[model samples]
Target chain A: MENNRGNKYSIRQRILSSKLTFTILSIIMGLLVGAIVLLIAGFNPVQAYRIMIDGVFSRTKYISYAIIYATPLIITGLSVTFAFRTGLFNIGAEGQYIIGALVATLIGYFLELPLVIHVIVVFLFAAIAAGLWGGIAGFLKAKFGVHEVIATIMLNWIALYLNNYLVMRPFLRRPESESSYDILDSASITILEKWKYSETGREWLSAHPYIKDFLSAPANLGFIIAILLAILVWYILNRTTLGYELRAVGFNKDAAEYGGIKVEKSIITSMMIAGALAGSAGALQVMGVTKNVIMLPVMEGYGFDGIAVALIGGTTAIGNIFSGLLFGALQYGGPKIQPPLGAPSEVVDIMIGTIVLFIAIPKLFKIIMNARKRGEKNAK
Target chain B: MLNDIGFIIGTSLMYAAPLLFTALGGVISENSGVVNIGLEGMMTIGAFIGAAVGYYVGNPWIAFIAAGLAGGIFALLHAIASVTFHADQVVSGIAINFLGPGVALFISRLLFNGSTMTKSLSFSAKMPRPLNGLFRSNSFSDIIFNQYATVYLAFILVFVMWYTLYKTKLGLRIRAVGEHPASADTLGVSVTKIRYFGVILSGILAGFGGAAMSIAVVSNFRPTLISGQGFIALAAVIFGKWKPQGAMWACLLFGAAQGLTVYLGGAGVINISSQLLAMLPYVLTLVVLVGFVGKSVAPAASGEAYEKGE
Candidate 1:
């Protein structure tokens, strides 16, 4: 019995110390904090949370919307995660994203080509533009010893204004609207978009109410692309020699240099790839949902959200998909609580913040474990 | 023509004041070896608190102080996570950034009857213009001198900070702790305490910067009000090479660029688009960083968690 009890205690300690365990605990703690905040603000926490959950899962359409939101987040999260794995903090994902969207919008509006080729060209140009945007920071960091953080932050602002300037131009701006003109039909990536609107297809969808509802959303191939990209990133990081070199550089730059890895080229390449990922997110967003670029007074925070997703996901490719979905669900459902429960949508922000905060201090778990061990020792 | 120049200078001072306060905060916190990217969040919280309190209490001074206190409270979280728990400073800072704005907006909506923006303060409730009646309206002197009280406070604090950093023993200890906490520990200085002080102080000053914008520059707190000023101040801290006076100059330069944008937009003397003009400060900072400021080294022990006996 004594041996069994000791074994149980050790097992509990081991489980408690695991990263997955910590992540789950942190998420729970975050929800608890959100509940407390809701309670203090004179709202029913249980009811609010129920509404939020219902908002995401109540309808097939809602689930599609959630997925739609998750698509960009997953791509951007992968962008940040890739840069992080290479030991570079790519805060300029926001800038790269903006550049991608801008380039994609320009291409999608101007270019008239065959269907498959049109979409491919749009993605290619957008990715290249954003990759070059990110590469500028890498170049600055490599050659001039400028910090990536500052360079990226500045670049984010420049990108924001550049987007605004381009969108406002007479050639791009939609008449009587704050956004750019919609992309050509060929450039759109929405799944079954034309078919769903067609008479025969509408009749078919009407017979299947769930499919009809799902089709009502701007659901596109972005999610599939995101999944494929995540798997590709995973394979690259785990398999390729380039990935090995980048990981080595990330682990220790001095050691990587001593080991004869070209650190400068690696940094530049990592940033470019990261930029391309973020750029792809923007391109997909334009092609799938908005279909046009809207001038924003402030950052829309897809990139910042990516940072949170990457952090929560443990900077893993697969982990980002899950965390991105979680974030997307929260973002989609957060507004629902505001309308019905009279709770603020910012509650979602608080929950996300709390989760990130708890994750940051892993020592809290260690402290608890140490105390528990001491308690056991004292009881014995 | 003189009026336009005066107006531009006034606008520059108005813009510079908020950044100056925040940059000073950055200098102090960074001097103590903490990288505070969350200054933006602290400023956001401060902006909201200042506006909300000013609207309700009808007293700008009280609102400003409240904003600072709110910021300090938030900074305590950063200090706890980074200084005590040995958490990643950047990660902790990012969390604080999210929390600060998140809590601010959540409470702002709760208080303002579901609106993200706070109610605007009356002119009397806003930050008082100190030299308002001293000079003729629209005169160059009036435009330059008849500025918000926070503007003067920001300038004064710069000198005060410069003196403290260069002259005082406390400043020396803060610097010593940042430069080499292990050595500071050997000398019986509490590294943890000093860092906490530095971070919290930074938060308070950042809060003041936010309040300066909300209560003085404009009239109310909106979602976009403190958008990138915190970040610009951060750039100023870097551009200034981590010196208090240097940061002041950097803020002034950025502020002047802002003034130029505002002046050119309002005056329409130049047909430049406002959006393109708005990119001036950020672009200039990047150029300055690349061309002039080669490698601005941070404090020796900055961003590293100090472990005892390690």
Candidate 2:
């Protein structure tokens, strides 16, 4: 009996001490702040939240759509997560994403290969373009001592204008519209109907005729690719020597250098990899979702969104998958709930911002824990 | 030909004024060893408040005060998160950036019945122009002298920032804290107070900059009023090598890029796509960073959290 009691108490103690507690607390705090905002806006917070939750999970199609939405975020989250693990802030993810999309679009437009080969080629093109784009900042940091933040921020604007310029004129220009022409059908990812139904020769659809919504959803190979990459990242970070060196560089660059690691090389490699992840996000976005490059009136800002995902995920591969799903659900579900609540979907942005802000200040949680500990001691 | 050059110069000055204020704000905060990436957020809030208040109160001066106060208050959140809690400054700044637009748009929707822009106020306030008498005779002189009040104020602030950083006892303490806070603490100067002042002053200046966008340049505040000028200001701080005078020059160079874009694109003198023209300032920022060889040095303690007696 005493052992059972002690076990329960220790589990509670572990919960209090674990970093997950703060992560959950920050999320709750963010929700409560969001609730207050909703209240001020004259909506019932509980109902609104329920609507949001229900909107994301009401049907299998909703769930599939959520996954589709999560696909790009997961990649971008991993991009930021990978960079964080290497002790570098790659704020150029947006630029990298753009460059990747541009490269992927070019390859998709010009090339006419078999379906699988075309996809692989597009991915490779995106990764290399974005990798080089990200490496530019790393090179500047390594060679010229330029701060990555300044360099990346500049790159983002340049990429934005470049994307706009490319979309508007001689490169991928549509005569009547600002957006580019859709890529060849061979370059596009197969839809769910083709993936599942075609494989089973109509047997799968006969068994699940009610799943029309599921068949219509844009979920593609990209979602599976994102999941595989996440798991691969976890394995690499835990098992690989390269990952070990990267983490060592992140933990302490001078010490890593003393330990015979090539600090500059690691920085460049990590940034390049990070950029590839973000670029893949762009490639997936174009090939699987948008189908073409639409001229952006303003920045799409998926890169900044990646920052929130990474921070919420605790900058870990495993955490990224979960948090990426949450952010993705919020994003996909936000608009669905908007009409009912008469609230602009931007409340989700507020929630995300608030969560990140709370998570950033881990000291607040620590202070509260210390105060609680002192209170218990006095009682004892 | 000279008249056209003078016109471009005048437009450049007008465009540079807001950027000048924001860059000055960035310099102050960074010099105090705090990395403020939330200039965009602060400017957004300032633009909204300045326009909203100016419309409601019918006084641009009072609106300016409200705008500055709103920015300072928003910055306090950053100070508390970064200074008191010792959170990562970049994360805090990003939070500020996200929260600013969300909150601004929300409030804008509430007050304006779903419109993102505030109602235009009839009374527009500008800076005191002292050079009007000197340039009254010629068109070139008119182009130079005909400007909003903020243009002159921004130029004067260049001198003011330079004087404050180099001449005063407070400036000495600010520089000391930025360079080496631990050493400054040993000399009995409070690093916390200096940093707070630096950050708050930055908020105020950036607020004025945003206000200049809505009240002086444009008639009202829209969600996109400040756009990416705060970021341009940030680049200016880097391009200027973190010096007041240098930032002023950098702002002018960037402003000229913008001025050229507008003038050439509007006049159809530049045959290239407007998108390419729009790309000039951003591309120049990259060129300036890469091409400049002096190796700009940041404050030694910048981006580090200082704890007393640690």
Best by TM-score: 1
Q: What is the TM-score of chain A in candidate 1?
A: 0.96
TM-score of chain A by itself in each prediction: 0.96, 0.92
Cα lDDT tens digits, model 1, A1-380, are 88877674567667888887878888998899999999999999999999999999999999999999999999999999999999998888888999999999999999999998999999999999999999998888887777888888899999999999999999999988889999999999999889999999999999999999998999999999999999989988889999999999999999999999999998999889999999999999999999999998899888888988899998999999999999999999888999887799998988998898888889988898799889999999
| Candidate chain B TM-scores, in order | 0.97, 0.94
| Model 1 clashing residue pairs (backbone) | none
Judged by lDDT against the true structure, how good is candidate 2?
Answer: 0.83
Write one digit per residue (lDDT tens) for candidate 2, span A1-380: 78877675577778886777888998999899989998988978889889988988988788888988888888888988898888998778888999888888888888899978998999899989999999988888777777777788888877887888888776687788988777777778747535564657467666786465665677678888888889988877778999999999999999999999999988888888889989999998888987778777666878888888888888889888888899999899876656776776777878888988898898999899889999999999
Candidate 1 local lDDT, B182-201, one digit each (tens) = 99999999999999999999
Model 1 residue A343 lDDT score: 90
